[model samples]
Target: MIEVENLTKKYGDARGINDVTFTVEKGEVLGFLGPNGAGKTTTMRILTCFMPATSGKAKIAGFDVFEDSLEVRKRIGYLPESVPLYTDMQVPVYLEFVAGLKGVDRRDVKRRVSHVMDDCALNAVSKKYIGELSKGYRQRVGLAQALINDPEVLILDEPTIGLDPRQIIEIRSLIKSLGGRRTVILSTHILPEVSMICQRVVIINEGRLVAVDTPQNLTAQLQRSQQILIRVGGPEKEVLSEVGKINGVSRVSVKENGADNINAYLIELKKDMVDAGKDIPPVIVRKNWSLHEMRPVGMSLEDIFIKLVTEEKIN
Candidate 1:
């Protein structure tokens, strides 16, 4: 539902985003990830029509973000990082006002406001002034306004900022539930949140598109070997020596020494090696050692993000 090609933005000499190209499929929830000053918010603003890119093109729901901004805005809801809210207005009143601004039918404004309030769990604070609400509640109010129009696309920038743990989970669940119904571009520094809620991720760094793929796929692409963590009740040195000799085991190191002679070892196998979990157990048993746990460990999303962002510096 959204397409951006070679989009570039600049504030004079400082480039916001350069040659950043990606597409968000209809009904897809895409995570936009980057470190601070990585142009994530800049890209979102261009896509949401909050700002124009200096060059290149962005289209939302088939309408050009620059040429048909009004039509594009009509089909998308945006919750910026710093929500622009009327502190003087009551929760429901503020939402109702936004609903009207989004061109919701007057007859359905009340119903839309009520529905979004419930969806955002803001019904209890419906009568409370936004200025009086807590930070978390105000963030919810921002989200409520975004959904008031039931737009086909939602561009949420740090939608969970300032939310408590419970509120974070509630908001995550709400965003996840919207996956197949609305095209969402979620920008946040929280890596795990993206892993849980986003179908795919677009990672940018230093104003350039670094990588874009499913988390699982990215892990596979970046992983050069299989890492297995195993806990065994045996002499650490002997177990390490024996495991190191096992076929397909390229390297082994003691991760931790536990009480009662139990130890955790991290084993690294060659990329083409046989399954370490299956091969290492029988060896441990024959050696009269207790096999407590064996599991393959893959690179996490955070690891992938770090690698993608730092690979250039390292190289």
Candidate 2:
């Protein structure tokens, strides 16, 4: 329900985002990822109508962002990295204020405020001032305000920046629950959050769109070969020779396992033979080598993020 086309922003020559473009379909949760200073926030601000782009166009719920700023803002709920909050107000009061500002009917304000407070697990501290709450509670308060109006689009920037592990999981679950009902654009440097919560990812680096695809697709796109780690008890040279002869085997290298007589090997299979892991053990058994371990090595999101960002710099 969100579309950006060549969205560019600048502060008098210092670039914010250049030719940034992507889309988030209805009920789709899109993870917006980038390193620091990569323009993630700038892009989000423009989409949320918090700021105007120097050039280009953005639309939310089929309304042009520039032409229908009020409509766009009404349809989107934004929780910025530093949530703008009234520290002196109690949680319930603060949320009620936000609900009113978001155009929630005066008669429905109490029900809306209470529902969001419950959804964010802030009911117990409803009467407590925001400043008196812990960082995690404060973050929840920020999220509650964003949900007060139940907008069709939610734009969150660093929603779980400083929370502890437990708190992070709570917030992550909350975000996940909102999927399929709200179009969400989550902007964060946390890779695992994207992997666990986002349906697809849009990666930017140095203020340019680097890649946009499903996490699995991006990993597969960058992978040139399949890798398998195997541990066997046998003479190193003999084991290597036997495995190297297997069809689709591209290369074999021995790795130190720190155990006597037990050698580890990293086998690289040709790109077309991704399932080569299934063909390895039989070769070892025929040679009388005792296989200890056999597992595939998959590229994680962290690895993919670093690889893509570094490649962008080199090119």
lDDT (10s digit) by residue, model 1, range 1-315: 999999999999987999999999999999999998999999999998988999999999899999999999999999999887999999888888899999999999999988988898898887799999898888888888889999999999989888899999999999999989999999998999998999899999989999999877888888888899999999888998999998889999999889999999999998787475577988998999999988888899899899888995575
Which pairs, if any, clash in model 1?
A: none
Question: Which segments of model 2 are wrong by more than 4 Å?
Answer: 258-260
The candidate 1 region of ten consecutive residues with least summed lDDT is 270-279
lDDT of 2 by residue, 1-315 (tens): 898999999989798999988888999999999999999999988998888999999999999988999998999899999887888998888888889999999999999998898899987797799989998999999999888899999999999999999999999999999999999999999998999999999999988999999988988887889889999999888888888988889999998754767988999999998877777898888888889889888899899999999988999
Assess candidate 2 and give its lDDT: 0.91
How many clashing residue pairs appear in each of the predictions shown? 0, 0
Candidate 1, residue 301: lDDT: 89
Q: List TM-score per model, in order.
A: 0.93, 0.97
lDDT of 1 at 15: 73
Model 1: residues with Cα > 4 Å off, grouped in runs: 235-238, 259-261, 274-276
